[model samples]
Target: MRALARLAVTTLLVAAPLTAVTAAASAVADPTPITVLTSDFEDGTVQGWAGRSAETLAPSTTVAHGGTGSLSVSGRTATWQGPSLDVLDTFVKGTAYTISVWVRTASGSDNARLSVERRTGGVAAYDQVAGNTAVTSGGWTNLTGRYTLATDVEFLRIYVETASTTGAFFIDDVTASYVPALPIQTDIPSVKDVVTEFPVGAAITGAETVTEHGQLLAKHFASVTPGNALKWDATEPSENTFTYTQADPLIAWAKAHGTAVRGHTLVWHNQTPAWVFLGADGQPMTATAEDKELLLGRLENHIRNVAGHYGDDIGVWDVVNEVIDESQADGMRRSTWFTVTGLDYIRTAFRVAREVLPAATLCINDYNTNVAAKRDALFALVSQLRTEGVPVDCVGHQMHINVSWPSVADTRAMLQKFVPLGVEQQITEMDVSIYTGSGESFPAPPADRLLQQAYVYRDMFALFREFAGEITSVTLWGLADDNTWLDTFPVTRKDAPLLFDTVLQAKSAYWGVVDPSKIEQTPPGTSGCAVTYRVTGSWTGGFQGEVKVANTGTTAWTGWTLTWAFTGGQTVTQLWNGTVAQSGTAVTVTNTSWNGAVAGGGSATAGFLGSWTGGNPAPTAFTVNGTACTVL
Candidate 1:
């Protein structure tokens, strides 16, 4: 998991083509706590927004044109050109907000309208409020409209309509803010739609027994895509030669467990067969035309045969892999595919895959998308493919993140840019490695490394929740620390980078999915009062707490059960959150919540009781479904 870096640009203006409105109210003496809830199109440059709308930034002065920002659409007659600003920050329900803007039209018939819209699961939208007013050709006129927030509004849009065939309208000084309210209950699911990659009958020959590893993987992951056995050398050892023997066992196991399988890759620069890169005399070709023909032929036969073999059994095929490089200062890396066939390789791969496996999802996978340069290259490549009539279906961001690079906000911002491309995205081969410096010998990881790993997982998953809909799936690169490639590759001997510890014990990363202490109970005579517990220690995904009861002295007893409450938003799959009959005065309540548990003697013991839905601000309160439980 990654932490988000604070963004530099906080204020954003989204403008739509309409009339300019002005009001003569003096600017509030105190800094206006005006939260621009949602704007149709009242500020910001045209390039800052998404969607296809025929609008242009024009100077406007109605409501003290805040820093010269306005938009004008040609021949406007109530035509919705999408949104001037397609993205927004905060949009919660059951609140009141005001939408203010300066507007004026050339003709009195020209009407300016403002609207509040909601993005369904952060993808599409629905309008919540539509306010319209007729504007006259006079000087800047201030217009203000207020609407009670609806449960559905997640995005905001403002549009101005002018009946005038030629003249333009100016809009400026727009703002929106919510009269603060209690936090609404939000139920954000941790899991989105499941995806399959490793197919049935694939090979696994690196380390450990395949069956044991497969079973462990099956417990947490819903599907498996071929790891790397489907690459050029493994799939086609020689030119015009193909084999599936090594891939058979993994595929068979996936079928037995009803796990979905995905094709590892159809085309890549590395691990390619020698013949494809050589000429008839066994020498690398120098001529562009000759190499281009050979590459295209190989790609066509490869995709047609392999994809046609599995047919609909495999869920997705990584048609092209690792085309963009964050370090590539210019753009995409010049891989063998690019060296020989040039940019045509991308279009051809998707085109051929579509021809053979029409139903199979085709993805172009890459890494370092958190970097703007790499992201720009990927976006351009995909956009070009779409324009060229290629059947590219999805984009795969190989989230091979390191501990200190590519912050969570960067990853989210990159994803937001791709939404308009209208294709699915996936976080493939996700593994966050800690940097102990290059060429450093791998050693038994210290406690700090383990703690850092857990923190990374916690933050990454929280961010993933915000973009669950657009993301198809997230795959861990390995099952265990020893099995992880981090230790062996890139100047070998790095620490573990998976959810499980070296001994196969679940770590704090695992506890992130399910916490055990949330279900465990305290012993009798334990001070039963609201207590603050520090997350003193953690493993993989589990944490230990030292909860201290202030001893308010209301009551005391010989036997006591520490009781905590859970809200409804999140379902408890497993629980250790109850009274545990124990030996000595200090009793330990083990978590029975699936695969998580609390550490012993990690925190001071405290007890609580009772649950309710809403309450005043309590930062330490663990909210589940818009409810707060009071500790007794």
Candidate 2:
């Protein structure tokens, strides 16, 4: 059920948080390659290559990378409009593919790229395979990257285009090859039994209700949340007309396995059809009394039929989703529903759901709730709604965290802040993302980043257990990395955020939650802080450095000052994400406005460009806020 609304918050905060494989391969192994498609354009034929959107595609005899001709793409008006080839028939799901293309711009320098476009359920998602390198008029540059096909595709295509230029470009030597993923082990312990403090769950679509994915879900999870099936658009696309085709299978599967069901989002700003906000004139509705009445009536009707259909089969309901925008002065998202009916829409959604399923838990959910300002705004709204005797029951924190953000202490504060309100809490949609910024796109998950992700899961799960009384349940956004929404959100790249890998095998992240000892990294210090220094890059007399300061104790530092002495005569000329001051070998760095606070199990990073003489060596000792840190 996580659409783009949560991604906006995740990107701003600079953090967040995979497929299944076959049964026969019992152990991890390197992916084996299989050539699937190739096009040198030597035959002087277009070879099913067509321009996407309004562009043109033709063979260019004058410019070729390998033979006498290459495919030319011209008349481009956008970055995505380029030559495309359908690969759905040839591509295999859950298998990785290496894409290679040779590119040359016709006139000037431009960055060429290879990307795959997937059309699933009428939605288009573009995943980058290779190329973002600058290419000029004459020289042909080889662009290469890798991709793993996601399951359940209606259509698929591989394309070549420039990053920003609308000018003409020529491409040659296109290819696609499949790489088999490592096998998943079936004898592993169920994740639900490991986290006995509360129920463990996942959000799923119809695909997760059958085949290997269904078996995996039924084995590891105690509850389920229908990702998009229960939403307004999926259940009731037209007025007074309803369809349960998508949601029925998922609900029935959970019930057959004796698993609990959490009906996701009785109402949301996104994904809801436009007719709900339109007036009798068939135009967009305004804030007039007539429009408000129409909007509320539609909302009531939608909730009554949708929630009434499931009844007690669904134990929990997200009454209103992503309705809090902390950036707003009033802490409210100005959706059309809010624009028309004010707060009555939320009140009506919950009240009607309670009437339809009296024993179900009606919760108000929002993302970025770990942020102090956002959670405070959510707390204020929930407090007011409950005080007014609305049927508000729980607060759902969409814990869409990343590997390097919002420490365990901050998450603890999120639950503690809601404790006084005496309302129940749940980690509604949890995932630990590997990439920290929008500028990054990895062909595959890096080993080091996955280790960091395991640590994030370990620390966060430990915090959730500490407040088990308040947090009644915790559900991951997806069952495995192969089917994550992160692939298309924030940016088009592969992300490993769940307990299982794309091939349906348990990963180090699963071990982090079920048994932390299996993870190989050394444990953090019990008190003070931990500091890691790395010389990221180095040239003749210049170098780039990165410093990560982690708060290892239970108390969070409102402000921190890190001091260290360089052994290799290094001088920091510039730094970002933190302030730096140096006097000879002694250096002191302080946090900036956005990254000053560091909670235990949470870290702050600062990078710098510096000048080094002779050989550059890492600092051996460091201190944060006057206390000595464990140098890592």
Per residue, candidate 2 scores C-alpha lDDT tens digits across 1-632 of: 44642211001011111111111111123233445777778888888999889898888897997669899888999988999999888876645455667789989898877777777689665665553667899788866654655356788988887788899999997766544444345788898888999999998765465556678888899999888778887788889898786688778889899999998888899988888778999999999999998888888888889898989899999999999988999999899989888899999988888888899999999899999989999999999999999989999999988999988888888999999989899999999998999996543454557789998999999999999999999999988875677765776566879988766777789999999989764445545677766553444566656677777677888988999998889899988789999999999999999988866556777888789788677777788888888765
lDDT of 1 by residue, 183-280 (tens): 21123222212112222121122222132343455555665655655677667877778876445555666677686776778888777777878866
Top-lDDT structure, candidate number: 2
RMSD of 1: 24.7
- Using TM-score as the measure, the top candidate is 2
In model 2, state the lDDT of residue 615.
62
Off by over 4 Å in 1: 1-211, 326-330, 439-442, 515-632
Q: RMSD, each candidate, Å?
A: 24.7, 11.8
Q: Cα lDDT of all candidates, in order? A: 0.51, 0.77
- Candidate 2: where are CA atoms >4 Å away? 1-28, 49-58, 62-68, 72-174, 205-215, 233-249, 252-257, 435-449, 487-494, 522-632
Question: Whole-model lDDT for model 1 versus the true structure?
Answer: 0.51
Global fold similarity of model 1 (TM-score): 0.50
Weakest lDDT window of 10 consecutive positions for candidate 2? 8-17
**Angstrom error at residue 187, model 1:** 25
